[model samples]
Target: MDTCCAKALVTGKVQGVGFRRAAQEQALKAGITGHAINLADGRVEVLMCGERTAVKRLAEWLRTGPGAARVTHVEFEVIEAHAPDDFHTG
Candidate 1:
């Protein structure tokens, strides 16, 4: 399968709501490799690289996030693929 990368900034009520952890779980399940982290401005940033379909699926999931998260917006960019060894949370 062809690989791809997605970079997204998830906004609104995302922090302190286990958003990153949930994203990591979702990514792993989808066979994505990258990281999810809390930004200083109270948003969650995610980088996912893997199969094109898997990455796209993960990006869609980011739109809603975990049940605890009130995802108001998701800004995403498609980039050149660079696969990581594993998914991570930071």
Candidate 2:
């Protein structure tokens, strides 16, 4: 399958709201590989690597994360990186 990598900076009430974990679950369900990590600037950095469609789908989801997340904005960009074997959260 054709695969690629993408990065997103999620902002607004994402931290401490199970955003990373939720993202991990979503990524795993989609068969995507990457990670969701917290930034000191209060933004969640999500890297998705997999089929283009799946990556885009995950990016869209970041717009409105878990019920507890008040996702105000999600900045996305295409990137190049090695895909990991599984999804992760940090």
Candidate 3:
């Protein structure tokens, strides 16, 4: 199976609002592997690895996050891809 990876910088109302949890759930559902964390600059950074379609879906969700989240921007860039047996939140 082919795979792709992306490192995304998500900004705007993304912390202390279940953003990380929401991202974790979404990533798992999309069969992705990576981690999402809150940065000191009030932004969320996520590294996602998975199939192309799944990665795209995850990115789309990042743009319009959970009901409580107000994501103004989701900057995504392709990165090195790897094969992971299971998805996880780190």
Q: Candidate 2, residues 5-84: lDDT per residue as tens digits? A: 99999999999999999999999999999899999999999999998898889889999999999998889889976547
The lDDT per prediction is 0.92, 0.93, 0.91
- Per-residue lDDT of candidate 1, residues 4-85 (tens digit): 8889999999999989999999999999999999999999899999999899889999999999999999999988755577
Pairs that collide in candidate 3 are: none
Sort by TM-score, top down from the best? 1, 3, 2
TM-score of each: 0.88, 0.86, 0.87
Runs in model 1 with CA error above 4 Å? Answer: 82-90
Model 3, range 8-29, lDDT digits (tens) per residue? 9999999999999999999998
Candidate 2: list runs displaced more than 4 Å. 81-90
Window of ten residues with lowest summed lDDT in model 2:
79-88
Candidate 2 achieves a global lDDT of: 0.93
Error of 2 at 28 (Å): 0.4
lDDT-best of 1 and 2: 2
Which of 1 and 2 is the better model by TM-score? Answer: 1
